[model samples]
Target chain A: MKKWSLITLVGADQAGIVAQVTQILAADDCELGETSMVRMGGSFSMMLRVRHDDMDLGALLKGICESLNLHLHVDEDVASNCEETDPDVNITVYGADRSGIVAEVTAILADAGLNIIDLETAVAGTADKPIYIMTIEGQALQGVDALTEAAKKISKGIELNIVPIQTLRA
Target chain B: MTVLDILQYPDERLKQSSKTVEIFDQTLKDFVTDLEETRLAGPGAVGIAAPQVGCARRLVIVDVSQLKKPVDNHGYLLLINPEITKWQGMEKGREGCLSVPDYTGNVIRAESIRIRFQNIEGEWIEFDSGGYEARAIQHELDHLDGMLFLDRLVSRRSDLFTRKTYKK
Candidate 1:
């Protein structure tokens, strides 16, 4: 029986991190699955799924992590049986930087039964006049109108725009 | 009227650039009829291109009259060898393709355009279009040059999204 494992790696950004890690996996005959690697705030982070049959992949990864001064975590991965829903709307919020922006916006979505499938936040502008921008791709379980009405509760100073995703088959 | 087969992506044929409609005759008119039928057969499709149906000709049909929400649109357009002479502004919008059935991507397109094309009768016509109609024309025009929305993705990582199934 093949086992699935989720591996996460985080370390200072440097070249060859992907090449070094993937090289080891290739040599071990580990089949790689869904993976996401990104550089965030001067740190490189990678999350990947691997399928293998009875290999000490964790020990090998640990050795590489120790040599490279990186952090690694591996855990058994179980595929979820839940039905997947596609996101139907895009939520954009931008305003003066505040601590509760994400919290407040997400709380409204949760109350409205909107499931956030993807989210990205960025801070821009000068240090003194920082601007917060957040974009969320969400599945509106309670319909777009319900989600829109619920979003009205969001406080002022924040500009919120909700656009229903229109898919054109041309 | 016949409904033509829409060639799916990776077909190689879809990547081939289409030729200009030089001899517009009964055969071209018949093909346009079939293409319109095929577009209507599709779910919520607003426009279709000649190459999509395996005919490598610079022809496209667009009709935004039936859209749920009212917007500025040219009722129904059947264009041959359409060309965008002028365009202004740019905005990122999500787009899906019948050829690439399983994915949607954010692509930046001109917000408005001045276009010229030959009607089915082989007479040249010029018009200005904005909003959804302009976007549809741009999308179909890309097919004439063998370009997909994937080719114009705003960001490879952040812009592409997958759909579980192409709703029949």
Candidate 2:
């Protein structure tokens, strides 16, 4: 079996940050897998999975972090073996931008015994009068009716839509 | 005719490039019927391709009429040897494939398209489509070339999502 590592880096955004990090990993004989990078606020954060035959990855990655002046975290890849549940319900929420929308909505989901598989939130419109939109894909631990009932208890101002997602192979 | 089983990923056959329908005979028409049956049987499935059912032919069926809000659609479309002549406006939307069960991804496709294809009757047809209809057409068209939505993902890791469960 191939050994794997999950690596993350966070630091100030700069040009050539990805290129430098990838170059270092390539030089270390590590095969890169899936990578995700996003800029939040002003800082850039990246998460990627890698596989390697050598065991000196931790020390080598730490050295690269030092040279790049970025915070680094590495962990053995354990997620591949674990069973992951797919979300059965698709939830969309959109309304005025407010502080507690996510908290409230997530709380409802948690209370319903649902697991969030994928979520994306954005604030659009304008800063002064912004519109917040959140799309959540969640697995139902209980039932669709239970989830729907839980969503109904949320505050009235926000608009919410809960639909069962049909998974097809084509 | 009956609904054919949807071939899953790693089946090897799904990766094979489909050939254009050279002879539109009774066999081809029968296979197209089976393809339509399979598409209708699959829950919430709006379109299907020939390669998904172990047939490597340039054929696809798309019908957005059942959707809640199908925009700029031609109701039901049976495309053979479909080709996109012009595309406009890039948009990213979530899509899942019947062959790749338990996963969905954000695929960037043209927001609107001017496409040309032959109908089931073997006559050439051209039309314009936009929004969800266009997205569905593109998704099915990719199958004819041995491509899945996963291959067109905007960002592999971020755009790809594992489905957690099924309701219907």
Candidate 3:
């Protein structure tokens, strides 16, 4: 029976990382599924889902990671029966970089029963005066109006904009 | 009126550019009726295109009045060989398509537009539109050019999103 597993690799960004890693998987006849690889702040990270019958795949990947000085983790993929829900609204926050911005903003969302599906935050502007910007895609369980009201609770100086996502079937 | 079958994404036919509509005969008008039926049958669909229904012709239907929220719009437009003659400003908005039912994406569209097209009688008409109505028109027009919202994603990683299962 084929086994489903998730493989994660993280290390210093370098060329040929994908080629080297995929070559090992290809030799084992693993069927690749969804994969995401990105370079973040001088570090390269990869997450791959694969289906294979080979039980020794973990050892082979571990050997390769050790030789290349990269961190690797392989684990069995657990299937969840829960249906994935789409985000109903988008929330964007912009303010001077300060502590507790994300925590405070997320707390308000939680209070309104919003489930965050995707979030990306970045600090921009000058080194001395950084601006924090966070964009959140969330499932609004309590409707957009409730989410909007909850956003009002956020502290002053931080700008928050909530736009309901309109789904057009065209 | 017949409810036409909508062609899903990756069908290859959806990618083919549609030909311009030349004749404004009764057959063309009948097809428009079927296309509108297909649109109305969709869940909250505000617009539709001929290519989406396996007809590779430059025809589209847009009616933003169906939306619960009131917005500036031209009620029930039947546009043939539509073209965006002028446009200005840009805004990023989330968009979903009937062809690509599994995903939605953030797409940057013109905030306002000046467009020209023909009616069922082949009479040329031009007008300006903005807001959600403009976005809907742009989306349906893309079908004529074999373009999907996936082609204009704001960001591959951040902007593209999986759609939720449809209720009902």
Residues B1-168 of candidate 1: C-alpha lDDT, one tens digit per residue:
998889999888788899989998898888898999999998778999999989999999989888886678889999999999999877667788889886777777888999999998999999999877898899999999999888888763464222221211
User: What tens digits encode model 2's per-residue C-alpha lDDT throughout B1-168?
Assistant: 798999989888887799988887788888888889899888678899999999898989988777654345698899999999999987656678888876676677787899899876789999999877888999999988888887787752343232332221
Error of 3 at B153 (Å): 1.5
Q: How many backbone clashes does candidate 1 have?
A: 0
Select the stronger candidate by lDDT from 2 and 3. Answer: 3
lDDT score of residue A71 within candidate 2: 93
**Which candidate wins on lDDT?**
3
Q: Write the per-residue lDDT of candidate 3 for residues A83-141, one digit (tens) a residue.
A: 43567787778899999999999998889988998887878899999999888888888
Worst window of 10 by summed lDDT in candidate 2 chain A: A77-86
In candidate 2 the C-alpha lDDT for residue A134 amounts to 84
Query: Across the candidates, what are chain A's individual TM-scores?
Result: 0.90, 0.82, 0.86
Question: Per-residue lDDT tens digits of candidate 3, residues B1-168?
Answer: 988888998999899999999999999989998998888988778889899999999999999986776778889999999999999877777788889886677788888999899999999999999978999999999999999888888873454222321211
Query: Which pairs of residues clash in candidate 1, taking residues 3 or more apart in a chain or in different chains?
Result: none
**Cα-lDDT of candidate 2:** 0.79
Total backbone collisions for each predicted model: 0, 12, 0
